[model samples]
Target chain A: MTKSNEYTDSSRATVNRRSFLKGSGAVAAATALHSPAVEAEPQAAANVVSGATTITLNVNGGDHKVTVEPRTTLLEALRSQLELTGAKPVSSDGSSGASTVLVDGKPVMASTTLAMAVTGKNIETVESLGGEDTDAVPRAFVKHDAQQCGFCTPGFVVAVRALLNKNPDATESQIRQGLNGNICRCGTYNNIIKAALDVVKGGV
Target chain B: MKNFEYAAPCSENEVLQLLSDQSGQTELLAGGTDLVGLMKKMIVTPDRVVNIMEVPTLKNIEAVDGGGVAIGATVTLDEILAHPYLEDYPAITDAILGINSMQLQSQGTLGGEILQRPRCWFYRNGQELLDTGQISGGDNRFHAIFGNNGRSKFVQSSRIAPALCVLAAEARVIGPSDSDIQMIPLLDLFRTPRQEGQREHTLLPNQLVTHLVLPPVNGGLNATYEVRQGAGPEFPLASAAVSLELDNQQRVHQARVVLGQVAPTPWSSAAAADALMGQPLDAQAAETAGLAAVEEATPLSHNGYKVQLAQVAVKRAILRAAGLETGGL
Candidate 1:
């Protein structure tokens, strides 16, 4: 969990395009491109970055450097690059909590979050929860049999842990509201809720 | 997704310059919840993705000159929900709670929520925005009933638009430079796309929504009531937001009622407001207002049920704002 300044990938991974115009927000002026094809008028803002670039991500209290494009999501970096595969990819819309990970203690859908956008964030995936003997969330899930297909178990466990970490005394209704982000396609919601409740009631 | 370049500008001028200087298309990324999904489906393929979450100016939530609050565009929904100054505005908070998912509330910004695109199945599946023929013939159980004027049948997809519109919120937009700023009503920002180049919003390709200003409620009480289908992070079936101020006799002196998921934009019903203007909020008055709200709704073949739902939402919103019993969940 100590901070590591090591570059996992030393080379500044080349991106497809290079940086463009940069300036101030309050006092500085900006120039507009003449074309209309790729223009975004809604809320045009970002550091001009194109092609692949090496960026460091701090996940599970450990910093891991990875090269990613603008399109490479946090979930992609966690699973594909860093091999932190606890977060699942159930639905692309990110409504499913299967890709849920806590960034700075907020439950966010990693699949929808671009890796470059969360470069300096504190990410905690399900793997961050210690071994089977140490984490009570997984224990509660096992005791309550909160899985059938088991595809959504890791996410549920992580999401439940996150909820409990924030609200240790979260009631059943609060648990339902808190964990609504994660869905069990196998219809294990009843058991999942029970597991969360067990953890809340100190039964786990 | 396209191999688009990404930019994370620090200042407003920098973002504006990138929006204009970049030859190809550039999309602003705030939460990336809705935009990423669209990009993955190839519904929108921008050449450059702009990350505006880190911009210092767009991150403020402070009290404005009026007793009202001015929230920066990048302020997250959960942050707004937690703000003490907004406690009286249940219309906005209730709508945010109705958003249902913590992930969305944690990541989605007020500007993103107000400016999000439609959830029309056809549109999401890659059909044109004005593809009225397919919308008319396809499965449109969740489509619009009031503002489907053959140009576009897709309903406005923002969950909190009705609430913000009823509050008469003003959006502050920044163009190419600081002098090129425009402050328009929040509702004025939306226009159903008529052409391929046009979008749901009226913003020029270079403009950015810097912040939003909500006028003080003074002695007004506001509430939002939504008729959701069921549990687990789904869009509302119908919704109504009411911002009302009553006279000494508990008679409605001012009323603003706006409906959502029933039209192309947040449909503010003057008739509904008029129905409540002189009367004390009661079951009969609420019923009358609700009926007036949906009287002009022209339901499509598959979705006549939404008219009744919209009516119920209006009735409940008024009753809730008056602190009266809604009588329905």
Candidate 2:
């Protein structure tokens, strides 16, 4: 058996196995495969728009040419590159629902998806929820005091708008479950749920 | 977050070539729902991220030849929940829906959710096991109290894993070579941490989980139950997914009991499954199985409540799947 401290080629062979028992061969092979790539290529500059891949994204109704790294998430691309700050980065992780956007008519966390991955798909953000005339969800949000710190309102509005578009007559329970992913740290959940119900019931 | 080179390969062969060329330093990005968070937290700093979304073959959901389902690695959780064929497999769909939040379901791919890293506090907080001379003070409160099996104490994060385990799903992995396709049993996807190191079964730098194949549930009843502490968005304290295959005589033919948030991986108890086998899935059988499932639980100082909670979850899940209400049990 190879000592754990020493790197060996056999360790690389067992890379597929979940076990941590690194033999010499697997380590050597893994090292050989990985080391040369870093040494051969220079590190790419971060946040540089030049030399990045250009993808056509149809946001709302208009098309926008966004240059993004392959690793750039849809959330970052929209907020940083496109200057559409409607979808706030309240929760860096996808769980908070603060960065939610509609991709192909489905609500998803912009932070959890790669910008390049959604090429050729219909993408919509909070900016697209309301036409140039007037927005319904944001009005309901303001009327119901749904805006606390205002960081999570855009995501909530976008989520509720999508939910209503899918099921205009959605029940209160369905509305609750649909908006479960978007959290309100300020304890405005009751009002938020009421706002969604108000729109669904056609009371607003 | 450290800077890294990124590539989107359109084919499996191209992915394999990239993995072969940059094995250890390269990491595969599926949905980035989990990977991006970890990268931002500096938990896993890779030199290259090979995004696999551009690979068309890995993004399909097809009907298998043997009446089962073949879900590609890139199949989103939203697609799985909305698939008409998955309605018959209610247990998996229930688990998928239980993840509940539309944001995650939309962005979280089935493959990424299955392969996500653990949510252990120590691991997430970046506690170094080795004494790296940076900290002169010995403050081991978080590191010592909740740490399990002595090593890295990160808890597994995927809520769907236990459900998939009970369903006996098969994970197809594509490695550095064209001939490197390997099918790993879902049961072996997790490993407990050693006494002084990180948990095993964490995906290696090169391997990509390409697909998950779930066998058809002919007449099995399946259900999942989760207990969240305080109702905010967080990992479950204890969750259980149970599936039972019944014969024409109403006797249990085969059963699988998987409990999550209890151990390093989704814990599968043969004892629990054995307790219900050859017996009718009545109230008594389910109670006995629930108690048998947690017999080997080695709870930490603060997590002792998990043992009883886990047993109750298992019992409730089994009863729910069996379609029996425990009104007075």
Candidate 3:
């Protein structure tokens, strides 16, 4: 079947709907503070019953009330539940660092951090930096072919974003040290570093 | 992973209460770097986990007024490397940076790294070597064919422990009851495996390590040099960390030398330290100290090469610390 025939307008609409729902989740979460006390009561009750403690996570100028298990890793909570799949899970073990996220303005392997442990701090993932239109890292990644299987892309992107945010004018050695936690088993370190440098050079 | 109960207490009193309430079945979760990995591997199956991340008193880095820095148990290795005080203490920073891999550095806490289980293939594999209680296959070859003392034949995981020993750091452990804080010399923390089923560190089930206090460097050049087989998911074959306090004329005043991946604990070379104490840090002095450090080394059938490599590392590290070129020593 032709590519055009395979993707019907209905499938396109379904994709759009999913994106809209995700966007709506973000909006609802944003406006949650101004929500009426009556409406907030049910949400708070839901969170308690869902085995999630109320965590005041400030991310990119927004506060989110996410419910999570006590032992739930910050990476798993961000991806599987919050749909913030920016931090990829390269290895179930925390060694590969496909799950790097910033907590309280410091980068950490989210896979090794329990979600509830970071209850009162700020947590930032790749999505916090790159909106759909203004993301330079993802675009440069495509230009440089920094990703192969695409499984490790989100983590690299998030980690680089955190590094650049901390040090926008990072030297090559600094970039290497900053990104040392992340590993690309496909041997794409050169391209990945180049992409990161591209962003730094462009001052993006 | 089994479902476990978690508690984040705010105060030391509360933490003690939890430990007292759930002594045997509970595991303290600091950075969760090693604990989570062990849980995934099924090496540990705790029914309850007590998270001390929220206890602000336990996560601090403060100066001790006299000299030295107190690093909290939950302080990440990245924090230690970036701390301004560590700049004055090169040996501490060198060891912290030697962990090298960013992922491990970010999540591996100073306390957790020191307390982490040995990286034995048999223990990590879990099911295969249940009978032997070792971490590798009984081929006793490949990863296992090294300077193993037969009982818990595994390499120590932390690169920083040896460095800490060289700096004469002290670990402050909070008791299971949380009423008193005990300061133990870092060297005493590791026990021979024969005493306790091959686990080196002497941490009781309910006790928690609150911080590591690094004494001040009086006036010495300190350095750590490591030699790994390769830089991927493997521990070092031989490594050495040396701290030498120098007098006005560059004569050694006090010396601490520690070695890693050669024994179960951070092996201190008192003989090596004694050799360098009153002498100038020259080629002759370094060679004497290096040779003295490994004189009693009993290598496994396949690991005799480690003695030579460790001696070389000791020589290079001392040379580098002394600001001398390592000229084909």
Clashes of each: 20, 19, 5
Alpha-carbon shift of residue B118 in model 1 (angstroms): 0.4
Best by DockQ: 1
The runs of at least 3 residues in candidate 3 whose Cα sits more than 4 Å from the true structure, single-residue gaps closed, are: A1-67, B20-24, B127-150, B195-199, B230-234, B325-329
How high is each candidate's TM-score?
0.90, 0.83, 0.83
**Chain A of candidate 2: what's the TM-score?**
0.72
The sequence of per-residue lDDT tens digits that candidate 2 reaches over residues B1-329 is 66677777665556666663433466778878788887777877777777788766567655543456657788888888877657656777867777777777777788888778766555566855333332223332222112254444445567888888888887876655544556678888776656444434645546667677777787689998876664445667788899899998899999999887776567788989999999998989989998998887766545567777788888988988988846532
| lDDT at position B7, candidate 2 | 70
Number of the top-ranking candidate, with lDDT as the measure: 1
Q: Tell me the spans in candidate 2 whose CA falls farther than 4 Å from its real position.
A: A1-56, A67-71, B20-24, B128-152, B193-204, B230-232, B326-329
- iRMS values for every prediction: 13.5, 12.4, 19.2
Q: In model 1, which runs have C-alpha deviations exceeding 4 angstroms?
A: A1-47, B21-24
Q: How high is the lDDT of residue A94 in model 2?
A: 76
lDDT tens per residue, model 3, A28-93 = 223211112112222111111124565655655577777776667788878877788778877767
Please state the i-RMS of candidate 1: 13.5
The per-residue C-alpha lDDT of model 3 at residue A123 equals 84
Candidate 2 local accuracy as lDDT? 0.71
Write one digit per residue (lDDT tens) for candidate 2, span A44-69. Answer: 32221213778888887779999877
Per residue, candidate 1 scores C-alpha lDDT tens digits across A1-204 of 111233112221111111111122311212211112223344454446778899999998989999998888899999999998889988887978799899999889998999999989899998877665568888888899889999888878878887888889999999999877778878989999998999888997
**For candidate 3, what is the DockQ?**
0.12
Candidate 2 — number of clashing residue pairs? 19
